[model samples]
Target: MTLASRPAVVILSQASHALGRKIANAIDGDLHGASARTSEVDFAFDEAKAHLSYLFSTGRPIVAVMASGALIRILAPLLTDKFFEPAVVAVSDDGASVVPLLGGHRGGNDLARKIAAVLDGHAAVTTAGDLRFGVALDQPPRGYVLANPENAKAVMAELVAGASARLIGQASWLSNTRIPFAADGTVTLTVTDRPRTAAPLELVYHPKTLVLGMGCERHASTEEAIELARTALADSGLARESLSCVASIDVKADETAIHAVAGHFGVPARFFSAARLEEEAPRLKNPSDIVFAEVGCHGVAEGAALAGASPSGDLVFPKIKSKGATAAIACGPAPVDPDTVGRARGKLFVVGIGPGADQWRSPEVSTMVAASTDLVGYSLYLDLLGTLADGKIRHDFDLGKEEARVVHAMELAGEGKSVALVCSGDAGIYAMATLVFELFDKGGISDAASRIEVQVSPGISALQAAAARIGAPLGHDFCTISLSDLLTPWEHIQRRVKAAGEGDFVIAFYNPVSMKRRTQLAYARDKLLEYRPATTPVILATNLGRLGEHVRTVPLGELNVDDVDMLTVVVVGSSESRTVVTGDGKSWVYTPRGYSGKSDTGMSKEVSQ
Candidate 1:
């Protein structure tokens, strides 16, 4: 079980938080805490068991700073596939003992060791192979792929039973292990980059010594690039599992075909600048003047392959061209680190955080924010992110500088940084998402900005929060309108308000009233009163999901500008909407979905029957 990018260190009590923080820092993990019991954590969870299960299901390595028995109990039911489950480690509350509960051979044992080292405690690694030989043959270190894990148990058993093995190929780590090596032995361990099958008593390991370099024309089909890459590997007698990464010129970073080829081989897609690739011109076997003229690189495929592999790496297969794509293969002396070579494609995530509450924020939004290298947003919205905003490069903008904030985020992402543009409520509803696309459509941005990837993550909207707080006022049809006439003309706003009134649609008003702009809300109320009844319920939900939350209802005729503010979301019920006052003197608002008509029709049918 390969752990995902970041692990989660969970603490259930404030007493364990200090130890949890130490482990989290050592591993660069996010610290999570039970919301009701702990504070000042990166993420808050309502329940420990549910959160642990969620983290495990998402393939995130977990280091629970709790009792081993309790942690096991929470995750026991989910223990199905050890090969796919993330590492699960348990650390004592006082940080004395670290135990690898599951996925020991995968990552748990390693994580436990690291944490134990940090906490100055003991790592209770109970894996038989690890304890005996200081290595798990089934799970080799990075840059080496176990060809046949199914055959590992038999080989490990033989070695554990005091049988000697012969090393057929180069493996520095294995030499350091406790395995007894002999010139003539029954069991065998072979390590090579070439494609080979293991015998029944032999273990085969593939060193990731190959780099697949690719280049494609703009808008090239993913199938063509993938096929070209596969053919290059097959024709060169190379194993696909031996590839470290798929690489190309930086200009093609966002090109779908380049990413598709990388995805096909289950490797990262790295990129090199044209100048960087051009530096390898002396090493290219197929240097093309045409390519140099096109992208300032004599050989994108060969250059990228050599550059990505290593300075002394050689191209095993020269550039092979398809209709609109080219591929090559290079062999390095050792495994290549994709991150050491070049930058990744830039990405801008336009995310909405909902109404200032951790529980209201979507898991997708949290994930994106955690992955981002930079946070760009209004200052208050960034504050709402709480500890999730820790360690990020924050570019805080004042309110009303929405365009500036969006542009900054785009420019940062254009420079190969993962940037999150934070907004309140839903990003698509009167937020930065519209402006992001608008700038793209207008086409005034830099080349890098235009090519950067953009993703929009939805959040709980103010309208939804307002409706939820005040029963189901939005149970029927509803439309949201912004009352701020700063960007939009008042006539257009008046027209939308009048139209919503005429349509008898339940209306939710955002930006209902600002300091200088108070009359718009009154106009909307008067306009809505013309269509709906004076006694119709009007819900004013302020600070929907945050502290000092206030939700109240009043008659449409009595809706005044003094009662509304910029922080408030005004929801006006339609003619069919009703307000129910309970015995507790609390008012709840909801619009019937014409259930009365259905009931009456059913009654008539029953009477006829």
Candidate 2:
């Protein structure tokens, strides 16, 4: 089964939509919206229950931006095995609270806390062990696996009830994690990745520390390669689940059978250059001159296995061969750290920092940028990051040089360094995320980018920031349109504007008026006036979520072209959008979601004392 690379954030209303996007950004997850609401996100679902049902089956973490009661009602039917269930969290629409609804130990609690940090809110974690001891016996960090998850509940209960626990293995990482443990106790926890039997009332965890090296002929069958690897593991009495990755020479980087074998075992296929593999020649059990002539390595399988393994690692299985394939296994020393043993796999993070404001930026964006060794973006945008961009290798280009920026970031990531391709507002919304994917699809320089792990982090878009600045003008159905005709033809822009007006969608215009391009915004205004009334509330917000921000409301007929610039986002209200004079004597634009009579279900409103 294929696994989802990231978590999903589900939103149902306009208030929740912004918060959901922030959560998704902080976690580098997919933003999903309910179809009933006006959603500008990654994916949309027709029905909430059906959407949740599908997400649950994917075995990926899920964060729902909705009321707790609604989430519980939708997921009650899908509740089965707690051990295998993915983490599910419920976040309030106003970003006030985060609740871990299920899989608290397995990831929900951590996800909720992480989201809370981004939103400046609090996590309502109810797990007993987590509350008392700040520990979850079942959920360990990367490279660690729980052997008997069934016994975790009993042990956690005892720990929460003030019973002491003893750790029986070397776990330096746990010391900083503040897990409650004693030198002597009734319960014992064994932390080892190797094969072992569990003692009475004792829990065992397996860390991923085994490196499997594989080599196959050019046209070797996938079945033969996979079977041969499995046979070798079985003969050695080693659990396949403990294998961290499959290692091979870079010459076979694109080899189909090798990748197929790695996929079958649910591990990544890591490739090393011939020069790197040759360094492990002395460690090879069956060195060959013919193999050195063919691949410039004495032993492809054995050399690669040893090269990827830790310094203290030893070859456990040596050169087990099939008709057209060869396999070897190297056992890393106990307490094997996966990140340290193998060559660093490249990673590219496409990040949106949210409308040029530090406060609006999610914690995930900050963390990702801090972790990245290289940063690529427009020169001005990089400068906006200020001190956060310090010490990292920054590759800045002109505003229009999007392709060059992406290419540079991809190249750095290909060299096994962490890279961040930064953008303004939401990366997926007419930003660098699309360009990065396009570059990857176009091949050549992007081949390295395609192979490297990529993640897109959402951010508060210009439209969302403008909507929040003014009241909720986008409470109902809405669509965003960019009036810039640089890349897209004006004909297509005209058609989209007409369609959006005909559909009665609340329209947000990006790149409304530029110095050279002036006619498109005027033409769009005329098209919108045909369907909307003269008194329709139009919001003009400039520099949203940044310094020198300005927001004002005007009637559709009175909108001045001079007031809007390239930095401004103009949101034209739909027919259903209404205006109210608040206590401050200012007009607030809002479109009712028609949940007026429904208790406990409405677009979250600001409460005034």
Candidate 3:
């Protein structure tokens, strides 16, 4: 299945002997002639798994020749992946062009025409979409990710009717867009990526469109302005290149940021009228004394685009400054056109940075945080992000109550903004993420919230971080019991701890010893002593991965009651978890390697605590 351009023609020759020479010649521009493989007949295909399927997968359209019904049957299944399936056309060995089967997009349809031209005959072309519209934008060869696959056929059909069409989304990243639909004050959009610059009348898929207008002092430092702008975008988790253009007054053509920003995104810098700017001054981020005296524009692109939107989304300053400092303007969740309703869905991400530090933060969770527009959490959690939290909308509430924060973040996302509800440690380990779904499951989310996208990006849990800090106590089967009893009964906690002890499983205790709940860890330790030796290693990693953190691993008999706290993770090692000293005398912890399938490394060869 060597894919080439769309086929010019499909030759249904009775045998390869008649037309093989000419067919190979046209395919490669160089003549392979009739000497190609010809003994490929009358054998089971199971014995003939020898055609070059690799060549067809190169994304080149191919012209496939099916000489017989057996060939068609074999080729039919092969063509399903759009790789090996090239344009297939059939011709009689008498050199008469006949049936042209599948693939107008593949090289088959084009090949049929080429072969017909060479043979002085007519090629069979049955595709109306190709003949009518020529090429379409939604038909980008390799990189087109259409938001609505179901509506594509209808959209294409509408385009073929020669209706005036335009594309308004990040879809403009495409090279071959040929839609015939127009925006009649209806803008369908996806706020996930930068949108292509478009007129008022195009159908677009750019989900991350925003109009930014700046009025800075003459020769404002590009670094200051850029940093400010970048902070605004980064805080929103939106890409900068998605800015269609930097729209400004004609006076500031020499302003470096206008060109810098446009050049950064590889787009044009559009100029708006000063009079229009005055009309829009009301919508700018700050009611400035300077901009009025100089640029005289309130919101250049932001206000105009908002005014242009179908529902005319409200103008707001999502960013704020201490005084008359750097400035910005934000617009939209501007109602998408009826056609663009589902173009791109908003995303809500819950991130868990394990127990107070960067080392325990999972890379995936960090990425989601960096891509979020707003950060909602207890103040300390948001503060942990530091510089990363500079530009985002921060909703810092009190500790022990994150349910309201989660609801707020989801609401923001429903309005077309990407939000991150921050959690401590793993989002699913007694974190807000599970509560979010549980809330959604109970119909707590609205219609808009339901339409918004939500996904949980997990991070390392506190207990995992604690265990890793001490030893591989959780190497085998283990149970995590919370001793707080705030969410569950103390009797149930005792029952679980007793079961774990009876089962001889290692136990990782969370919320082990708080100021009020002091006896559970002692009770659990007492219960564990009944099942095994009292000298088992007890790893206490307190305030792990944070400032003033300390790790202590001691035998169970030497466990200190004073060191354990609610912040501490208590790992009571199993029979196999051991302490070992490396050749360099560095004390470390690892589970016995017995189950690692390397039988050579015995348990006794290493030092154990």
TM-score of 2: 0.58
Q: Write candidate 1's Cα lDDT for 1-609 as tens digits.
A: 122659899998898888888888888788888999988777889988889999999889899988899998889999887777888999987788999998898889999999999889999999889998989998899999998888888998998889999998898989899899998877899988878888998998889989998998999999999999999999999888899999999889789999988888899888888999999999999899999999998999999999888988999999999999999999999878776767777889999999968878887898889888899999999999987897789999999898888988998988878999999999999999999999999976777787788889999999999988879998889899999999999999999999999999999999999999878998999888889889999999999889899999989999878988789999999999999988998889999877676788786785587
| Model 1: pairs clashing at backbone N, Cα or C within 3 Å | none
Candidate order by lDDT, highest to lowest? 1, 2, 3
> In candidate 2, what are the lDDT values of residues 101-138, reduced to their tens digit?
99898889999999999999999998876776667778
Among all windows of 10 consecutive residues in model 2, the one with the lowest summed lDDT is 600-609
Against the true structure, what is each candidate's TM-score? 0.93, 0.58, 0.45
Candidate 3 has an lDDT of: 0.57
| Each candidate's clash count | 0, 0, 45
Model 1 spans > 4 angstroms off: 1-5, 13-15, 32-51, 600-609
> Relative to the unseen true structure, what is the C-alpha lDDT of residue 78 in candidate 2, on a scale of 0 to 100?
85
When 1 and 2 are scored with lDDT, the better candidate is 1
RMSD in Å for model 3 = 21.2
Q: Which residue runs of candidate 3 sit more than 4 Å off their true CA positions?
A: 1-345, 593-609
